[model samples]
Target: MLGAGSWGTALAIQFARAGRATVLWGRNRAQVEALARERRNCRYLPNAGFPAGLTVTAALTDALDGVEDVLVVVPSHAFRQTLAAVAATGVALKGLAWATKGFELETGLLPHQVVEDVLSGDVPTGVLAGPTFAAEVAAGLPSAMTIASARADYARRLAESITTDTFRAYTSTDLIGVEVGAATKNVLAIGAGISDGLGFGANTRIALLTRGLAEMTRLGLALGARRDTFMGLAGMGDLVLTCTDDQSRNRRFGLALARGQRAEHALRDIGQVVEGYYGARSVHQVASRLNVGMPIVEQINRVLYEHVSPHDAVAALMRRPVMAELV
Candidate 1:
């Protein structure tokens, strides 16, 4: 683990549970030291105690010392920087994968692209993603995830290394599809959260989710991602989970926005990185660049970046000219 955040802490617990002697690394020296002393990440993953086999480390190299597989679980914004540091270490890692689920903010590149650009050799790499919430995984509840890699062997290696009885792993070769779906769903979750916060009924929520899936599929297809991948765990599955679940920071952030809170204030109150808020602008930019028709994403961009009222955003969505549902 390369991040000490909720997701990273949760995954470290899973790795330990799976009988691996896991080492979790974080950038914050104080936080890593605290996790070492307390055996729990109280700040991010409160009430979740670390397993005996799990060791917390402030030193990046210490965490990678003789490790079989390395998981980069940092935030999307920090993914490149952290990996750049990992590359600089020259540890010659065996199998590497990331659990982060968004694009690089500056270059709008996927996690794999960052890995390829920063890292030096042909280090077997993949991504672990799906509709998983860190809290549930930490609690050892049943959860399913998708591992995508260009190299099927790498995906299998990562899946076998991390998968536990409670945490299941499925593999796919459609890296672009998986990543595009993962990054785009957070933006869709914001749309769902806004709808729910406005007190919309089931019909409206379903509409948002369904249409949001279409928008996601459209963009994914434009990016050369497999169309069928959108229906899999990383696409529709993750989208539903993030959009409907209250534990989702993106959804909660959208709810706060709908409840008349400023973006900065709501984000501060949430106390976690709302991936949707950051992803929305990037997705919108990508869609625009591709000339893809992503109305739902457009509305979310207007509401989040352009400071359009949530009500007006919905009204605009509703007012769009009707067309065939399959378009």
Candidate 2:
């Protein structure tokens, strides 16, 4: 595990309990030391107690030492820097996987793209993603996820290694679809939050969510992703969960925005990175470059970065010329 946040800690606990030796690394030396002493990540994952096989470390090399598989669990922004640091260590690993779900804000690259550019070796890489909350996984509740890679064998192996009776992982070869869906859903969740915050009822929320899926699918197809992939766990499952679930940071951040909070203030109040704020920019860039029509994403970018009022955004969306529903 290459992060010590709530999601990473929860995964470390699960893998360790599954009889794998897991070492969790955090950039914060003080927090790593505290976790080592307390045997629990009290700050991020207070209820998720660490198992005996789990260890905490500040040294990137130590975390990579003798490990067969390396799971990078850092936030999307820190992913490249962390991977570059690990590459500096020159550790040999059989496989690499990431649980992070957004593109790099600077380069607008997906997690795999960052890994490809930074890491020297041709390590088999995969992504583990779905509609799962760290708290639920930590509580050992039943959850299913999707593991996707360019290599089918790698996807299968990763799924087998990570899946538990309570935690199921399905495999897919549609890496692009998985990644694009994972990235865009966060932005849509923010829109959902704004709607909810404005006291819009379930009907409005459902319409936003359904249209959001269509917008995501359009972008995905433009990028050469399989159309059916958008209907799977990484797409529809993730979209619905993030949009409806109150635990979602992106949705809550949107709620804060609708309630008259600025983007920076809402993020501070959430006490976590609202990935949608960053993803909106990246997706907007990609959509523009590809000539893809994503009206929701466009409005989200304006509301988030351009300081457009949420009400104005909604009004503009409603005022746009009518088109065929199938478009």
Candidate 3:
């Protein structure tokens, strides 16, 4: 594992429980030291402790040494830097999977694309995504995820290794759809949170969610992803969970924004990088470049970047020209 944040820690613990010797690497040496000594991540996931066989380390080389399967769990923005470090280490990564769920802002590439570009075409890369919450997964709750790769055998192997009765893993060959669904849903969750903060009723929230699914499907289809993938765990399932749950950081950020807080202030109050904040801009850029009409995503960009009032953002969405549902 190449990240020590909540999700990384939680995943490390999960793999450890499966009797896999896991090494968790953190950018913060002090945080890594504390986790090594205390068996707990005090900052992000205080309630969870490291599994018995899991080891936390600050040394990059130590973590990468003799590791066969590498799971990169860092934030999307930090992926290139982390990959550069991996390249410098000269590790022959055979089976690598990324859990990061956003596009690189500078290059406008998905996580898999970044991996393919950075790894010199040496590694077999895949994605793991779904409706997973770190806290729930850490607590050994039931969760389902999709693992996608171009190679069917690799995807099947990954699914077999990662799946358990509690944690189910499904396989897909639609890597583009899997990634787009995961990235775009974060943007929609922010819209849902804004609705909640504005005291919108459940009916309104349901409508927003429905429309959000449509937008996600459109973008996925345009990107050559199968439409059915958007209705699966990585798409609608994730959107429903993140948008409706108060435990979601992106939704919390949106609520704060609707409550008259600046984006910076809201992020500060939330105390975590809401993927949707960066993801919204990326989605807007991609949609515009592809000529895909994602009006909900456009409104989110306006609210977050152009300082459009939340109320007015809602109005703008409503005022768009009406069309047939399937059009």
Candidate 4:
């Protein structure tokens, strides 16, 4: 693991519980020392206990030493630098998996794309994504996820290695589809949260979710991903969980936005980079470049960065020219 955040810690704990020698590499040496000594991540996931087989280290080389499979769980913005750091260590990675679920703001490349770009020249890489809360997963609650790679065999191997009775992993060869679904849903979840925060009823929320799925499908199809993948666990399952659950940081950010908080203020109060905030801008940029129609995502980007009020965004969406639902 290359991060010590909540999601990274949860995955390390999970792999450790499965009897794997899991080493978590954190950026902060003091935090790593505290987690190693106390057997807990006091900052992000305080309720969860670190498994016996799990170890924490601040030294990236120590964590990368003799590690066959590397899981990069860093924030999307820091992914390129982290990968470069790993490359500088001159460690040969056998198989790689990324759990990050956002696009690179600089390049608009998806997480898996960033992995492939950073670890170029025939490196086997995969992505894990779905409807999972880090806290619940760390606490050993049941959850499901999709592991996708261009190679079916590699995907299956990763799935089998990570899957347990409580944690189910499904394998897919549609890496693009899986990644697109995962990244795009975060943007929509913010819209859903805004609705909830504004006291919109279930009728409006359900409508937004359904439309949001359609927009995601359009974007995915434009990106050459299979439409059905957007209807699967990595897509619909993630969308439902992030949009409806209060635990979602993206949704919480949207709630703050709806409650008249600025995006920066909400993020500061939440104390985490809501990937959806950056994801909205990235998706909007991609949609513009690809000439794809995504009104909801556009509204989100406008509200987030263009200074468009959330009320005006909603009203503008409602006032758009009506079209057939099947379109």
Q: Is candidate 1 or candidate 4 better by TM-score?
A: 4
lDDT tens per residue, model 1, 11-95: 8999899888999998889888898888998887788899989998889999898998889998788888898888888898898
Writing each residue's lDDT as its tens digit, candidate 4 over 179-263 gives 8888888899899999999998899899999999998888888888988888889989999999999999999999998899888
**lDDT scores for all predictions?**
0.89, 0.89, 0.87, 0.89
Q: Quote model 1's TM-score.
A: 0.97
Candidate 2 colliding pairs, count: 0
Q: Over the stretch 74-141, how does candidate 3's per-residue lDDT look in tens digits?
A: 98999988999998998777788888988888877888888888788556678988899998888788
Report the C-alpha lDDT of model 2 over 1-327, residue by residue, as the tens digit.
Answer: 999998899888888877788999999999999999989988878877788999999988888999988998877888888888888887887899998878777776778888889987778999988889989988889999899999999999878876888989899998889999999999999999999999878988998998899999999898778999889999999999999999999999999999998888889988977789889999999888889999998998999988998888889888889899888
List TM-score per model, in order: 0.97, 0.97, 0.97, 0.98
Clashing pairs in 4: none
Candidate 4 global CA lDDT score = 0.89
Q: Candidate 3: global Cα-lDDT?
A: 0.87
lDDT of 3 at 262: 85
Q: How many backbone clashes does candidate 4 have?
A: 0
Least lDDT summed over 10 consecutive residues: which range in candidate 3?
A: 116-125
